[model samples]
Structure formats: C-alpha cells, structure tokens
Target: MIMPRGSDQLLLPVNPFFIALTLLLAFAFMLLPFGRHPALPDLLAVVLVFWTVHQPRRVGVGLGFCFGLLLDVHQGALLGQHALAYSLLAYAAISAHRRLLWFGVVEQALQIAPLFFAAHLVSLLVGLAAGGMFPGWWMFLAPVIEALAWPLVTIALLAPQRRAPDPDENRPL
Candidate 1:
C-alpha cells in the first residue's frame, strides 16, 4: 500500500520561536573562548545556512544581515564586513535551495562548501581592504569545518521533527 502524502510531512511544525532560540544559541557559542584561533568556524553562518535551506521564506537574507551586523559589533570588526558576507551567503543558499533540498544531507554539505568559502573570502577581502592584517592561510579552515559539520547540524536540528517508523506497517497510526 502507498503511504498517504500527508504522512510524509514532518510530525512537528517548524516553530519560529525554536529557530530564534537556535540562532541565539549559535551566537552564544560563537562567543565562547576560542582564544585567538585564526580558523574558528562561524557557527552563526552555519546556523544561517541551515535555516535558509530548510525554511527559505522565514529565514532569508534579512535575517542573515541582522545576524551579521550583530557579529560585526561583537567582534569589533569594521562595520558591514560580516553583513556583506552573510548577505552573500544567504543569497547563495537561497539560489540553491531547490537543488540542495533534493539531495541527501551529505551531498548538501558538499554542495554548500563553496558558499561557505565564498562568505569567508568576502570577509577576508573586506578586512584586508580596511587595513586589517592578514589572518593567515589557516583562515580557509572554517569552511572545511563548517562543511563537515553540516550533516551533523542538519540531523540535530531535524531530529525532533522526525516521526518514528511504524512497527506494524500494515496498520495506520
């Protein structure tokens, strides 16, 4: 027998409150003591990409811009550096959302790697233009770390919505 189309939907709704809370948690994680690590992963960017891919309408470039602005203020970086980078990142994610959604999480992670790199590259270029010292070759590490973390993040965020498989498929829940 075929499963009902409605059953394919996640059991839990994607609540905006949870999304906001997750973003706040990611921001706090970013603030944790990394102690001058040049290659720290941007948890905020990862969270942004996660939400953008899963809920494009609710979490788009505007949210990215706001979060990036917050990050800039927190980091004391030249204003608009992260805003520009995250806006670009959101644009890239929005552009690829359809295709990315069709793929498995691992493939999505692979596909998203370049977008993460582009965001970092934009930030680096902006920082350099503003007379900031080069952060070093290790700066490329963040994207790699982010990409690797993508599947794990997806699973974690989505786990609550996943329904348990019916033990008796012959019966409907």
Candidate 2:
C-alpha cells in the first residue's frame, strides 16, 4: 500500500509498558500543585488523546474513563465531569485516527484542536450545570495550550518508536 505523504516512515511497534508509563506520568503531572490556573493545559488530556489516536486498539475509551475518574477524585470535582469529557475526547480521537495519521504533526495538532476544545467545553458545561463558579476567561486558554502542546508531545512520545531497532551501516530505514 502507498503510504501517505505526511507519514514519514514506519514506526516500531509501540511498547505497552511505555504507554502505561506515559499515562501515569501525565497523571502525576496533574497531581502537582499548579494552583488551579484556568489556563493550565491538561497534560493528561493531551497525552490521552495522543495515545488514543496512535494506538486506538490498546488505548481507548475505557482507559480514558478510568483516568478521568481518577482525575475527578483527585480534584474533588463533579463525579463524572472529566470522565464524560475524556471519554468523548477518546471517542473523537479514535474516530479520526485513520485520517489524523495522514497529516504532519503540526497539521495533526491543528486538526485535534477542536477535539481538545470540545472536551474543555464539555468539562466547563458540566461544571456550570453543577453550580460551580466560572473559572473566568482564562479557561479558554487551556485548550489552545493543549493544542500548542500537541507537536511537542507527539515528538517526545514518538521518539522511542523512531529509533532503529537493528542499526546497521547499510540499513537506512
């Protein structure tokens, strides 16, 4: 099959342990005392979406739900707020996974911007419906920051997969 122009090369099979480690690391990042800044990007969401898109079969809605619940418990927010948002985010990423892979990292970032925005929107709406105070205009910045983070996260996460498994002078794959 002819590969898409945007897909530069084949990737090594993803390691399951690496995926779990990244997810756990993102979760740990969320647990940091960031003072609840409204514009703070959701590193967990960004990482979740990346894995959902890249490894749909391995990382899907269920994982998103579980992590979202954990985040909810951590933040003491409405029970299913992040769960609903993340599940939807994962679903959207999985739905667009095939087409999303055909774009360069930057373009892929732009494409997923709406998904991140929508997830934030869902979270905001849920919070509002629960009578939570508005987090102010800064709330909108999170999704943009998350979108901006896409390329960096993509590059970092894909680094391990980019290395040649069996390097040889004559093999330039």
Candidate 3:
C-alpha cells in the first residue's frame, strides 16, 4: 500500500521518460506468448488508465489513440478497434480523475473496473462491426484481472515519486 504523502512533503517529480519506458515495457509484456490465453490482464491498458488518471496532461486521448493504433498494428487486429477503446478509456479516466484521487489505490481499482470493462466492450463491438468474430467470453475477464492488478501498478509506479525518509533525522550519533 502506498502511504499518502502530506501536502507539505517534497517528493521527486515524475519524469516523462520513465512513463514512456514503462508503457513500452507493458507493450513488450503483452507480446510475450502466454499460450494463447484471453484472460491475461492487459498491462498496457492498466498503465494507460494509471497515467490518464494520475497525469491527464501527459497521457491523454492523443497518446491513447496512438498507443491503440500501435497495438492494433502489432496484434494484426482491425484498425481503430483498439484506438477507439483506448481513447474511450482515456476519456473516462480524465473524466474521473479528480474523484479517483480522493480514494485509496484499492478503492480506485473497484471504481476503475468499469472503465476497463467498458474499454474491452468497445473493442469487441468495433471488431464485431468490422465483421470480425467474437473473441469469446474470456475476453471479458481481462478487465477484471486488470482492475485487480491496479493497486500493484499504482504502488510500483508511485515508488519513484515517494519521498524517502531523511537519514539524518533518525541518527543519534
């Protein structure tokens, strides 16, 4: 659990480079052959949601659209399917950002579950409209997994932003 820092605390600012790197890593993780399972958490989507909620200016609809396009191309799926889904998720995150900030990471996950689920539904619907076959019921489970993993993602990503304890404050020498 990430302890909330006081408003007076001075923590390190988030670097755009690290955000991009983590997103890239998430994409690479998605490419790993997981034995054709559809229930795997979409790590990229999780990261997207994380940034969109926490840093709207850095990770907005434009970035989401671009990332979705890349994923579509990489996965050989219908173009605009993921684009629409990701953009929708970004929009939802931006809309809910303020509210999410008031909650803890675990509670935030519960609220975020619907966004992930809705994003998947948008993708599925777009694919269907494009004459693609249904991806099966397991696809729905992806959001749940992603939502459940939200707290972990939050903790990992926020580690760099957390203020370290001052070493000299505890010294008795």
Per-model lDDT: 0.89, 0.95, 0.87
Tens-place lDDT digits, model 1, residues 1-173: 66686745445668788899999999899778777577989989999999998889999999999988988998889999999999999999999999998888899999999999999999999999999999899989999999999999998888766654554676453
lDDT of 1 at 33: 70
lDDT of 3 at 10: 46
Q: What order do you get sorting by TM-score, best first? A: 2, 1, 3
**Candidate whose TM-score is highest:** 2
Write model 2 residue lDDT over 1-173, tens digit each, in one string. Answer: 76776757778999999999999999999999989889999999999999999999999999999999999999999999999999999999999999999888899989999999999999999999999999999989989999999999999999999999999987655
| Candidate 3 TM-score, C-alpha based | 0.88
RMSD values for the candidates in order, in angstroms, are 3.2, 2.1, 4.0
Model 2: residues with Cα > 4 Å off, grouped in runs: 1-7
Task: Give the number of the best model, judged by lDDT.
Answer: 2
1 or 3, greater by TM-score: 1
3-24: candidate 3 lDDT, tens digit per residue: 4555333456799999999989
Q: Give per-residue lDDT, candidate 2, residue 164.
A: 92
